[model samples]
Target: MMINSDNLCMSCMKDIGTEKQCPYCGFHADSKQIEPYLPIRTVLGNRYLVGKLLEYNGDGATYMGLDLSTRESVNIREFFPENIAQRDPKTLGVFVMPEKETIYNECLQSFTEMWRKLMRLSGLSALIKVRDILEGNGTCYAITENIDGITLREYLLRNNVGYISWEKARPLLMPVLSTLGTLHASGIIHRGISPSTLVVAPDGKIRITGFSISPVRSARSELKCQLYNGYAAFEQYGFEGRQGTWTDIYGFGAVLYRTLIGTDPIDATERVTNDRLMVPGKFAEQLPAYVINGLVNALQIMPEDRTRTVEELRAELSASPSAVAGTGVEYEPVVPVTVKKPVAQRIVDEEDEEDYTYNKREAAKKRHNRSSAVIAVCAIIIVLAIAFLVLWQTGVIKIDNDTTTTAAAETVEVPNFVGKPYSEIVDNTYNTKNFTFEKNEVYNSTVEEGYVISQSVDVNKKVPVGTTIRLEVSKGKESIVFPTGGIIGTKYEDAQKYLTRLGFKVEKSIKLNLDNEIPDTVQGFSLEEGVSYEKGTTVFLFVWSEPETTAPEEEPTSEDETTLDDIVDDTIDKIINFGRGN
Candidate 1:
């Protein structure tokens, strides 16, 4: 944070002297090593004073500057890729070699369009505030409001002990998702969202910057991507890969991985074959299992394999029992650990308020942990005290009504039932007298199916000779049974509702197989009209494709659809279902 009223360091947005390299921030005022940079105090457009060379980037170098027109401090980005063009020191104008002129112009257009698109999102709060754009000094310049903030990377290195608990990480990331969602809705792909691009402003709001330096793709499928080893997704490595929301999803996941693990995750390219990157749970075992599961799924190298949107990734993070509480703390494991999510595909493209019985089950997975260590300790103390009283009452310590001497030592500490094979521990941990064991099977993504996910009572606690304890065993991931009832001839929406209640994501694809007259009913589904699929699986619903324009010339005159309205209904159904994706 070097700032001087007279001069400033461009790289750090700090105030330093006019020298070859900044003495205070180490910014190169005359960066001639990799490429020649503008000297200190160089003026752009005759109205902006360049103070110091900030830092070099893939597309250009950013610098600290002053707007002589308005007398305001600003940060400026200069487009100068040495591979494509050269800056004429005498004229301060960019000149491209004839052979490379085409690529240079196209890339320059992409760089300019990137900012114009950002300009459309002026109201978005999570975006770093910008001031203006200028064309001069042999390259374009993107000047933004001077921000003295710390990059998320710097903040992590300085503040993180290791993994910032979910308690602290969720709130920090939620706003980012909401912002990306807005960007997606705007049809803009941020292709850049790593720890380095995210900054925490002085106002405590996290803003994403470095938009001007986004890589410009060439016609040859060559991607000159801004590489941040662990943070860049696999698709970014080449032009053949599909780049979209999923690309950013991987970057966001990698950032979380670094935050949670206190180590850099392996690059997506390496994981395509090896997949040796450690899962989030391995580093923070106590983290709600969904967080681990989400990170793993998001980092999938295959674009189709990753969660498709920021919303989905956010949901996966919030899927944990702790996140639903929205208390910003990881809840104890008193309830089932795994939360059901729509597998990996999106049935609903956008946020729809439509009702689905399938989503309701999501609210039932949260409950407080009933067996903490303190309660276990107290239970032991009470049990031991009760035993002594029983001995006295039975005349072991004192004479009883019949003066008979009897002694009994019948008490044992409750054995830990969590994480053990339910079958192996059930008979041994149960008490014969007052206590009993109740077995419950629940779908848990983290714990192995048939293993114990949680126990009703704490371990190491003495409960009389027997106390009833219930164990929730992992049933693995959830499955859904598509109801076979009344789906035929039902409105598509109605079928969507019915199947959703059965715990499946419902999708409609135009039926390639259609009848001539029109189709008023759902012909069939991809699988059995009624069958089971893993929960979160997308159930494809098929409907007849719409007929060509004009009323089919003459109705099919089919027996059931003998009337005119029947013909209309079928055509309408086709028209509606035709709009849905396959």
Candidate 2:
């Protein structure tokens, strides 16, 4: 293998001459990387040149990497489950413990599957894009795009007020709520939703990242759990509790609370023992009534009593309350309403206490009238109750405890949609009448076109009527045509964006610009122009590397020079002055 040392520093991917240390980034090219982590410049999949270890948890380590096929920088997530796995020093492969091999394989599979699903959901507004998935060195790797932004935590700390107003937070948080809803619909629950996991981009939009397998997010699992103190839900702390979308709702509400109230809420574990969180009274004046109400409901200690869905949470936050009724709670009266105070109470003024006279006779008369009306209503209710009891004794009216009330929504069993023709699902009233179907078309070689490949909701599962079931219909084998014109000599960023918008992954390669070519411009594509390829094809884009420039060294001048004798004399004078107490 030939090493290309000219115009490239592997540590920082900067253009520099062959040197041990990278002057641009202070990275040493020949510095020994820590064991268990891949060595600097170690290539994965013969494409990604791995760099420094960015961060790691019990699940795996993330590294800064450059795609050799494309000159773009990317984040490579390697699945090295530290709990049950070890690194082979010589081969740089992960070695699982003798008894934990099955667990390791399962976790690796989970890491792979999660990234694959996230790859399908890449275009979500706030989700971090998963570029590709690879299996190498006895483990799996997920390639995610490097986002240039600070965490929501840092963003909040940088704010002058320490907290954000409801008006400012609504727009920032609503998009994330929408993205979380989409993730839930796709059967992905972000149990670790928090300000730390959320990145605020340069555009001021939030990007959701920090995804891991279920065990890493839950307590008492095989791996070490990484739960955010105040943001984790109560259910996450227990193994028996079933975690779902409601779990993320708790974390989301905590993030919102931190943003709006300017402090971390009580941790769910502590709240269980002593449930009290103090949101400042001033925040009530700053935030809307419904926004606070939504936060309270979402941050409920109990899962069943909490806001169960993202749509419900969003609606609640937006002043449209959709309260979930628990065992004894009634849903109708939960909507907050403003009421006018009585005229007598309204008339009280502290400053004008001596000016107004108390009307004792009027107040007494009003109380008597209200008591008489209440008595009359009670007499009518008693008479009706007696008549109903008499009729029940004579078997005129029978009580049935098993009867379903109008308030309880009727549930229908979900019908099997797999292997059914898409035409049959839409055109047939029997299938379409019970539920609203959301269709996603994908290419599958085995399944015929126009047939349902799979459904999100399982068959025979009882769900409420009008529940949405996501269906993936087949589109046969994909025949995606690569876009034409204005690609070569254009900026690679723009070209990559265009290609990505067309559902193609861009693999960038750097080429030396011998001619007077524009730096970072798209030189050419590996795929032929106007050619059709399968869906999700990696388009290799060769970009022109920027011309190397060396920094000019300055000549030694009298003003710029600092002599050793001058330093010594200054130190001695300081010592003498200190001794003399001058």
Candidate 3:
């Protein structure tokens, strides 16, 4: 009983030598290959049914997998360094002797401290939670719950949607702002907030992901991480040692500005500084004025002028009239009414002011009436003028020297010739005279179909009416079949010319590299080696590469020859044994 490569027992760490099942744990050893990394499905840890590879980044490669014990789908991120020396500080220092390990350690410690501070912050528990840490072959891996959503970058591209509509964008942006606020309050700064780092879920929830350059509270202040140019603050550009809440505020404003306007705010930074920021109404008119104003204020170059807290923005949004609807508030209309005064009271009031008040009321009423009358007369006159102009321009009415002309002029009646071919009319009847024939096409049912249908001019009338008579003729419906051609293996450029000569449009040709074994020609096309197409139809071809071109070639110069012994000695100032370092 020989055991195959895939049928290995976990406990014994050996191939299961021919038994009905694994003798160790009664588990079937013969499972399929999972992935490139894990060749065998069954492993020492609770067997995770390997699924599709989700994504890969500097942190790790994430895969969708199912836990056998729990029977639930889980995301597993496997972090493997492409080159161990790149990731391990100890090895990096040995390989690249000029590099400092203390600097690397300090950066890592800063990031770790920031992560702990952020995790302790309130309201961020659900946003990010450390699940577990697993130690693998010489490296550490952190496994977290898979965030089910599309990256903000993808969502923007797929929908051709941008941060234009506040109604559509508010949900996606509020959460990110809330998260940034929490981080700021906890004295942690997420120095990066680009579109790629923001993830928008199907439920409209947003989460900030990548935390590489995140900064935390430090004892000895010194800026360490590289500044993200796209979202970096002015202070970052100046290389200031101190970064506080305002630094994160700048990044948040940048992200918000980018989401609303398709481009980054800094692109218009000059315009903003020069007081020439384009009005949001010009791009998306439906966006509320106040919202645009708030965004512009937040993106102010001077950090002090910008909104200091996310709570202020949230309050402004909540207070907007657009946010309220159907909240049990009823609107009432106010009506004005006049009440008659009692005669005794009127007499007493009039005695104090009488004649002057009476005269003023009369003048006001008269002025109102006169204005109404003037407006009515003007409107009537304008209406009449417009009616007369319309009638005159359209020639609906015309007056002439005490006489009216009804445009009765000379015309010619159409001849009833039903069964005439197109050539006969041009050669015989309408030929030898001052008249010409204009050919046209028309569908006829009553008339014999292939002859003249009708004419544009009338049958017959009088004087100065010598005009060319237009004719309608038809060709009997006929169909022609296109010929098929031969297929030949040739270069792509030559194949196109050959197909064109055969009256076929070369639609597409895919070229594939070939090895020395196969000829560097179109091995074949998608069609039957060589096939002809209709006169105007296109032909598609596919070319494949040979093994020689597909394989990678070894370098002609070896590493020892490429490196100068003198330069190596000068850099290191000593000879170190690479084999003994590990």
Candidate 4:
């Protein structure tokens, strides 16, 4: 069966000719998209062919797209903060209210900058890969690889128990944890890490999607917040709350709670008022003690009380009663204790009040009797001892002495610190007094700055308490003198690779050319060639492109443009497409 690439279905990207309904995906081709969303088959960057709108949030809209160059499917994310920005149907460009222009532009930059960082940090197994970023239509677009899988929500629903055991979930979630730690190190915090943002592939691996700017995920920003009730941290609910790694920790803990308890935890706001979210006794019994403790601490309502780092959360999960005995931190397992009476219960009924009074009197009487008995027994024992002592004074008693022994010093295993952020570990080691860290700074190409490159003590080696472990922290890659004259006239692709290889962030912008010149070649650069620049410096390249040719214009109807109301309503229902893509 032959398929026409030009006549592809917007819903599934499959070929469907002349039929109003797609046979493959069961999508009605004639069904119109809502206002403010990209129209079906809209082309972007002269390469990506945007299909149906997949999902939208406070930050932007995501669409199913096809990479025209490769004919492969991709996910396109557009920056369109609804609360502060509006769309011009005539020009397909976004405009903001004059007063909110600054905030809108700031958030837009944040959206693009976050994606740029993610683009550089791609290839982590637990994270969706960001492929390319381009600017147009008064906004930014991030192109990411599409995942063929279902959301974690659906995955849990498909399971018989609607949950998984700790053993089954540990391997699946550890990658996400590690990836989060890396993201935090890179100054990126994913405030939205709920089940809907997590995708489970056919291989049974979970990958995180739905990345957005801070304002979109937090409350009281210029944009409307799209926070997951049970997954969002308490700090995200208020503008004055300071958020850090702990914000993501709360979401991560909520995810684990859902994965193990077979239900969503109570919303953070509700928990703040009336905290009734606890793991069921049945599920708690099924999980490891350390795991339950880890979940509780990570899901604390207050950020100060919550697990502050992925490393700490992992430690809690891996610890045992014996392992943490002398670590100064107690990991108490959750047990369902039955209390005969409520600690704060009040007796309102006459009969209940009378019974309580009677019980109190009975308890006092029993205490008095026990004290009298103890005192009488002690007097009799003292009298007997006095008589015996008097006899012993006459040399009637003899005693034997035995040798005493001294206990050995306590020892603890040295923890692995290589490749960890030195700042995170220093405080713990110093406070615990188990080991002392002697820090040294050095330049390294492989290790990230502020991270431990090497440690003097071997990991897992049993050492006595107060051992001084020398650590060398990375100062990041050493600065290098820019190479002379090799970056000017090369092709854009070649130049990008060259600049990136020399430790610089390369950004390319298309320069339209009417004069006969090489297309896709570098026309100019933002930085001078022979100057010393620090690693990770952004270098912009002006690339020549073919002159624009006039094409038949398509008028955008009311249904083709997305309104603020459309985005607001769509956000509430966007979870339906969580399994679709980013």
Candidate 5:
């Protein structure tokens, strides 16, 4: 329950019905951040209290809100497609631009489908949680549980001071990789898996945050999706490119590359022209060869050459001696031969605050070390002279020394637990006798519903034989049920949103205007919108048709276009008539 207190300061999630002032920061709620939209202190859907305008990502304007029912802080993401549609200040109706009406409706449908998909994925723990989806201010609001953690970018900068060793990074990456693998297998691609999107929770857990249907993608019928230059894959840039699971893999690889190297790799667009990306091993020899190879393979510019799946990438990243041998890299379980260099301390200007006493202290310590070395040398010489004198006086010397030691415990090999059944592993005879196991059930895309997807302990590792290992078991894909609610007569957008919000999938079609009916209004539904159905039941919606407008009659300005050809044809006709008369 480590909530990100950074965004929560604007309002007390615990005190949902409190005063207008922000409980933590004491900032007035009347601060109007964005314009041409809902003003400050506007309570959306009558329950979530709007606090502050968090950000204006390309797709929507996000607001930190408080849910009264749960009394928890939540991020309310509004589907404000500012490019194609806008909210009318006076009436508060979402009006699509006259030219972009068709695309607007399509984008709206896509938004609905995206939220529905998210609702279906509650089994995936690392995926951001969605509390509720509601219509507000003539647009849709997706309420997600607020996460409390620093971004991976912040963690890298603050904790690592720039970059970290592979040993430290391996553990940090496993949880995210496991979650992302399930997402990919469930036919979901993050599309945006940059350092900023990953949160390192206060409890040292990884929570992938910032889910936005990037509005700048050109490949699909939908207009545009948000695209990051350095992080986006090659296919995501244009309509001709084929985007798939590999698309997200590229972004994930880019983030991995960026974090490991402390710098952004070449942008996908630029990589096509000239790729000079230095491998991790090339830049840092101390890193494991397998990890270096894994990173390099993941960052391949072409999807065909790239690590095609999350499992493939994970296997490479978690490569053992045999795994590295399969990849043609020399396998050695010992420390790297290259000497690792310590991170250099930053140089400061003479007048800089960090320069004053620290420099003096460092210099004094070096001088003291030199003086101590000289004193020690003199003392050693005097001791040697005294020892020689004693030996001469005694004419003979005798010495004796004795040592005692104890034998160490013999170590035994750890067992392989990959793809093991959770039920059997938990209450198994061998499991109880030799080792202890901790099991967690999570949604797995490739692994069977009851089998283990991953284990914390390495297989065949000799560690006093009975080492306790933590295992993550798969529950398969979680089923989503369409919720039932009253939506007999609502606005077409409202109806689609209503059905969608209630977990009932919707398919809409406008009826032909044989009777000159109104357009974009909920005319009828194939099934009763009030009645609940099983999850993923698509309810076809019939919208009222708009009267077709005839194009204005064009002026007769085309008379001269047939001039030369018409005159020639007339002459030929006259000759033919003369010949017939003769």
Candidate 6:
């Protein structure tokens, strides 16, 4: 008889009786699996399997797996303790309580659903769901798209490799701000926003993850334990947990501060009482004033004192002088040469060392010669000074001043040229004495074809003479003609790329139907055969479903049909008693 042990393999549910390791995957039988389970190999669920035992405080044992389906690899999680507890419900509940587990499971399910709805509403791709029950276990599995880069915490620990320069931090902060805006608008507060949860992708995209401990209105009891130590707001620690958009605002500010200055924000409670908060410039002198001010507003103790929304923060950052002029570096003028003098030079007594040969006759002769020379030099200098003055006054020795005068010619004002033709403006309007025109193409909803959609400088703004006014000419509404490029039997991914290059976003959907010749190809599209849409419009594509192949129409021969039925019966028999005693 097979004796059941506490260690059960999640995959086949087999007991390696008295053995310290799994006979199938070699997973250590005695090790606790949740924290540092060694990932073993790939499994049938399109997953990279990590085999180990899982423990539960509330939620059940989780098996970690890597999903290979998406453009980027994703981390998949599976709960195994639920199955083990169900098998021996009487004894298992004594050790691993079931009441709290059930509550935690329900909370996880609700949070997952909420996340799915929010992602969909925000126009982000829905996370892929993996079927767990079909694997003949109570284990539930979920797949989340994996980020290619390091976590924000890891990034900071690396001495902020990418964030040391402000130029690098600007692009990094944009997405963080954008995501916060989306989360805040949905009325779901991310009470915990820290470096560990924010993952930076290889493409410079920042994705916020790890919502396991996140609080929802449905799970009030779990909120108390959900407080992240360094990241949680002060209101979260109080007896009455106060969570709002401001909670996330404070977190976002903390992340920005840590990224810019290599330091975290002060505790919320401490900041609330303290009048003065440290700014970014103090820590990193290279930081610009506008950026420092923006961070300060975001980290303000009071919600009302902080930026109302991420968009407002973005606008403030955009309008700052530092934003347009780049990081602000203060300039110090050079001191004048007249005010600085060399140290006093030491004098030598050369006369005292000279030979004692003082002759009165020679001295008298030298004096007479010196007087005659001085009289002659004075006469010559007087004539030269008179001539120089005459020449300077007459402008003969004129000095050419290169400095520009205040009354220099001014630039012509740019007129409202939105409705004017590109060629007309290029040839006539901007071809005036002091101005020139440069053309650029852009998509505009209101502006007509070939007309100026916008300009770099506003209308009536004065610019220096010979300045080139940059103009954005309307491309009229962007349009794309559908392609009939791929062969009838080409794969979906290749076909999708072909359409995407022509300025169309592809949407994939599977349809169940029967077709022998076409098998599983781009069956067709929702749009008409010959219709054009504005560029960037989503094009939904459908692939043939499994039913088309599973239930084929060509009648089988007697012997063949019988063989197929026999195989089906065997498969069903194996599934029914896969893990049961023989």
Which candidate ranks first by TM-score, i.e. highest?
Answer: 4
lDDT of 4 by residue, 205-272 (tens): 99989898888777655565667868988888773468989899989999999998889888887776
Report clashes for each candidate as comma-separated counts.
11, 4, 13, 5, 12, 2
Query: What digit string (tens of lDDT, one per residue) describes model 3 on residues 44-160?
Result: 144454433444322234455544555444555554322121334333111211353444345444544554564465246225444444444433334444566777767776666
Instruction: Score candidate 4 by TM-score against the native.
Output: 0.56
The local lDDT score (0 to 100) that residue 563 gets in candidate 5 is 81
Per-residue lDDT tens digits of candidate 6, residues 1-582? 222224445333355667776787665554332222223342535434444322121223344443333223335444323221343333212222455566545655554564554445444321122332212233344444444567777776877343455677777767667766776676656666777668866765677755443442112243223334335555665434445676676677778777876766566655555534454334435665556555655665555344545665676556556443443322113211111111111111223322222344655587699899999999999999999999989989876688655767655455556655676555331144346778899886556567777787787676776778888998878877776545236667887888888888888888676655454577778665547888888888887755543555897787666577888999888987876754
Model 2, runs deviating above 4 Å: 1-12, 16-30, 320-582
Candidate 2, residue 379: lDDT:
100
The deviation in Å at residue 84 for candidate 3 is 11
Residue 155 Cα positional deviation in candidate 5, in Å, after optimal superposition = 0.9
Count residue pairs with overlapping backbones in model 5: 12
Overall lDDT per candidate, in order of appearance: 0.66, 0.78, 0.49, 0.78, 0.65, 0.54
At residue 132, candidate 3 shows an lDDT of: 43
Compose the digit string of candidate 5's lDDT tens values, residues 208-317: 76666645343232433455557778777663456666777777778777777787777776777776666544445576666666666666666655556777678767
Candidate 4: misplaced stretches above 4 Å? 1-4, 324-582
Which is the winner by TM-score between candidate 4 and candidate 6? 4
Q: What is the TM-score of each predicted model, taking all chains together? A: 0.52, 0.54, 0.40, 0.56, 0.52, 0.41
Candidate 3: segments with Cα more than 4 A from true spot:
1-99, 117-129, 134-140, 215-230, 238-241, 267-277, 283-285, 319-582
Worst 10 residues of 2 by lDDT: 337-346
How displaced is residue 17 in candidate 3, in Å?
Answer: 24
